[model samples]
Target: MHFVTGGAFNGKSAWVKAYYHMEAEAVGNWFSGYRGDALPEDLHSAAGVIVVLEGIEQWVKELLMEHDPKSAQDMWHAALEKWLQWERGQQGRVVCLIGSDITKGIVPASEEERELRDTAGRVFQDTAAVCERVDLIWYGIGQQLK
Candidate 1:
């Protein structure tokens, strides 16, 4: 797995695209939460060698809406494991998870919002811990962290 993170309006998506060699044809393989795409339950039948899950923060928010914090965390780990399995099943397959850095903002006043914010950090950590490569995008530049 590969993880990419940065603040909103950063070049995360573009950097990821070029780094992964994702051309225009790669659009079909991209599942974006920004467009209301659901969290992937399975990718065994996915066609692309690189699977891109963009706007992961939105997906995390959706997950938190249905489950408690702990359960949501577990659910994310489970999904990551599933994606790992899928990636390992093929020689060239890769899973790319892109998330916005939500931890830099002020703590939200609403308990629910706060959970989402905190969980975003946890989610990024969870991904970073297992990812083969981690990167941060800033102002259209990508710096590798792993």
Candidate 2:
């Protein structure tokens, strides 16, 4: 799977969309979303392309707070690890991920903000292990990490 990750506003989504459109036109198939919240299940059926959003650490932290605030960090780790294992079980296919930069938020003055940043960094590290290709984008430049 290909991972498109970088700091905020790096245009990962735009890049993904452009690739999807170009691929669709070249093959005459519809691009769809699968495996994430942004798209529907019909995407898995079309077979052209599937692009999905991976959770930014902040979102995971917020979810933990909503579900179990006392042990949010532990929960985020367990949940994310489980989800990654499940995704890996899908055999072989191109899985593209869009992620946010969580480390930059460490400067926030609130406890929640700190936790979000930490959680996000951890999530990114965990997901990176599963990626076959990692691209870092900065100011419209793409750098391959894998």
Candidate 3:
């Protein structure tokens, strides 16, 4: 699994798409690529899975309020459990793409934004910890971490 991250407009999506295309071509499956809006059944057939999430903050927040009153951390734990269950059922790799600008200014000026930033950071950290490798994209360049 791989975790690819970057700030706004950093081409994280493009990078992931390119990686998938290149890998497909290298393996002689030139037709394979990301289908963002349409979840394909063949996602499990591939050797790995790449999940591109644009708004980690919002999603986590929504999940927290799914049943109301619960904190984001609780929701994340539940979501992780479900994810693990699903992962166990699939023998492919899973990659997650999330947006993050690690700076104080990007940290958000409102309570909502602050929560988002914090959740986004936590999501990135957790995913990266489980992934085989992590990459940071900036100015169309990729820097590998771990």
Candidate 4:
């Protein structure tokens, strides 16, 4: 698995498209890309494909509204576990998770917003630990983090 992260408009997706030499679309069951406000219900369906998940911060924000703090955290953990397991089960398949680096900015005033920020940070850290490559994009330049 690969983790690609950066602030908004940092060109992470552009870099990924160029590096992979393909657009974000389903191609012969080998690749799929998704950008949505919420996590897909059937994550395992993407098994055996190079899956790219964008706008993860948005998904976290959505989660914050629908559940309590602990519940939201549990949902995040469950989703991550599913993705990790799917990646492990598929040889030669890559999972590229893309999330904005929201923790660099000012701390949020609302408790829910603050929790969202913290959750995103913790998720990124944990995911990066297991990923084969971690890239941080800044002003369109990608720096390898791990």
Candidate 5:
């Protein structure tokens, strides 16, 4: 698994697509929470060698709003484990997760927004832990974080 994170419009998704040479013309293996795509239930039968899941912050906001913090986090971690297991099931399979960096120095004024930020920070930490590699994007440059 590879985790990529940076501020919105920082080129993380473009970098990943270029890095992987993601050329599929159709909605073959690329998915995004921004596009309303749910986290895949299983990658066992996915058609491509790699899958890209972007807009993780959107997913986190949805989950954090809908469920208790612990429960939402558990669901997220379970999905990650499921994807990671599927990636390991095939020798060449990869799961690339792209999240916009929402955890920053300034805190949100609203309690709800703060909660979302807090949950997303923990979620990103957990994602970094499970991923084999991590990258931080700025402008158009990508720096390996792990």
Candidate 6:
């Protein structure tokens, strides 16, 4: 699994598409009304294919707003665990996770917003720890982190 992270409009998605020889449609928009308890089952079929999971922070924000903290955490952990499993199972496939870096700006006054930022940061940290490669994009340039 490869993790591509940057601020909005940083060209992470474009880089992933070109790097993997994938069209825009090949990238899964996981944040498109994607409120769910489990990771999409069809991802299993993505084996030997290049799949990009975009807007992961959006999904996490939705989860946090819709559920209690404990429930949201459970769902978040489950989702990450499922993704990790799928990534491990992909022998010839590529899984590129694209998320915005939300920890760079000023701290939010609202507790909910702060929680979302913290959650996203933690998720990104965990994902990067296990990913085979990690890239941090800034001003359209990718700096390899792992």
lDDT of each: 0.88, 0.57, 0.54, 0.74, 0.87, 0.72
Model 1, CA-based lDDT? 0.88
Could you give candidate 3's per-residue lDDT for residues 1-146 as a string of tens digits? 56677766777766766866644222211121222222122333444444444444445555444533236655555555454555667566453545455533645678765665666567666667766778888876789987
Q: Which candidate tops TM-score?
A: 1
Candidate 4 lDDT over 1-146, as tens digits, reads 78889988889888877766666544432322234434664556664467777777777777777886567767867776777787777676677888888898788998877898988787778778778899999898989988
Off by over 4 Å in 3: 22-51, 64-70, 102-107
Best by lDDT: 1
Report the Cα RMSD per candidate. Answer: 1.1, 5.6, 5.8, 3.0, 1.3, 3.2
lDDT of 1 at 6: 92
In model 1, which regions exceed 4 Å deviation? none
> Per-residue lDDT of 1-146 in model 6, one digit per residue for the tens?
78899998888777876777666544343322223423453576553556667777876687787886567666766766776777667466666778888888899999999998988888788778768899998888999989
Q: Write the per-residue lDDT of candidate 5 for residues 1-146, one digit (tens) a residue.
A: 99999999988877997899865522658889989888776876578688888888899888987798788789899999899888988788889999998989789999988888988989999999999999999997999989
What would the TM-scores of all predictions be?
0.95, 0.64, 0.64, 0.82, 0.94, 0.81
- In model 5, how large is the Cα lDDT of residue 96? 93
Off by over 4 Å in 2: 20-49, 67-92
- Cα error, candidate 6, residue 139 (Å): 1.4
* Model 1 residue 22 CA deviation in Å: 2.0
- Candidate 3, 35: how far from true, in Å? 13
Query: What stretches of model 4 exceed 4 Å from their correct place?
Result: 24-37
Shift in Å, residue 32, candidate 3: 18
lDDT of 5 at 35: 91
User: In candidate 6, residue 53 scores what lDDT?
Assistant: 75
Ranking by lDDT: 1, 5, 4, 6, 2, 3
- Cα distance off (Å), candidate 5, residue 119: 0.4
